[model samples]
Target: MPEEIIDLNSIVSGRQPINSSETPKEVTFDRVHSILYGNSSTKLIYDNAQKYFTKKFDQTYPHTSLQRDLFISIIQKVHPSLKVQFVVEIGSFTGNSASIMGKVLKESYPGSFLLCIDTWLGDLAMWINKAVWEHLSVSEDGRPTVYYQFLTNIIKQNLTTMVLPASMTSIIGARFLQTYRFYPQVIYLDSAHEQGETLIELSLYWNLLRPGGILFGDDWGWSSVRCDLKKFSYMKNLTIEQAGNTWILKKPVN
Candidate 1:
């Protein structure tokens, strides 16, 4: 079999190059708010993330911070089965979220996995926004090289045993949805923010959740994300819990 081709340099540079058209005069309101309100621990992580990845962003990716806390909460609150299997994470950015989940999984289930799925590519919207992409390194196929760096960082953090990288996919890829049919105990969805992609992720992954499993999505109240999740509000037997930009959904164990 051919070795999987990866761009090590791109993985280290988590942001794509910014062009003149992409640069802005100053950071946005969200950026300032994030900086002001960020917890000390979160700020430290963000600082290290910027330095480790050499990437800058217009707005703070608070999803990464929230995801970490929520993931830890889930593990501590829910007792795992002796046969603890898998925790699925869609969109592993810099491995922050996965790393946190892995910590709990490592203690609960010696060899259980944190299976992450992402294309790691900056889409047209990402490029057009000219934000994080400017510092991200992408392969010829468009996957970010920072993915490898994320893996390496997690390993150094002692999370290697609990993390697994699955096949990559664009946020809107139907094939990816079909692939998600392999049910997981917990699924964390945080892919693209476009309406179409978010809807597809919800539809496809919702069913792949095993009984008693939980599904959570980031970017809940954000316009692009909120619009899509709102469509499911009227669905029978489904209730969503809102927390900042995170939305939690459960697959009842009936």
Candidate 2:
């Protein structure tokens, strides 16, 4: 029998493709063109992705309806290059909005958090709507249970790390603002679409935002929310833009 000889040069050049029986050599690899999801250009979209990923359990909260599309688009416009540090959200229904915002921040600033405030008690409609009573068996007395379940869902999603839960009116005090050491970069007012409540939410966070920070709300087309936002814009000399069911109020960039 003749002895077989291997061509070493061909093996090194990959001119001779290795068979399945051949073991490949291991070598170190370099990381080129790394992608940061929530970078300056894509932070808002990144946040929307997080919300979509966790949207299944969000049904309990009153859906934003037409406002959802506005949120998706708005998130896109909010370039991550702005480097807004904190986000404050009023009326964190089932925490869906907060979770979405938190996801965006996580991509750019992993340690950032969203402050979520709500009573968790169902809105006034919950007490008056016959549909809620018939479907979810959510009588006025059962609202607390429904609210509890919403928070439970928030926790199960591992959102507690990014969501700071607070009761209604709790975010107004000086202590709450002092905790951040800096003003919030974005403020969302979606608490109550009712006239009084909407006005209050706006008034509360009006001056609390940093000069370049933004304030937006859902149900912008609604009579109550719209009126309040219009007045707010005129009074503050700020411009309010409506996209779908949401309104955006931008504080002048300083």
Predicted candidate 2 versus true structure: per-residue lDDT over 87-142, tens digit per residue: 77777656667766666666655556676666666566655786643322344554
Per-residue accuracy of model 1 over 21-140 as CA lDDT, tens digit each: 443323222232243335433452323444434432222333364555667665443334314466678877666677777777787666467767877664455566556564345666
Per-residue error for 92 in candidate 2, Å, reads: 1.4
lDDT of 2: 0.55
Enumerate residue pairs that collide in model 2.
40-81
By lDDT, the best candidate is: 1
lDDT minimum window of 10 residues, candidate 1: 1-10
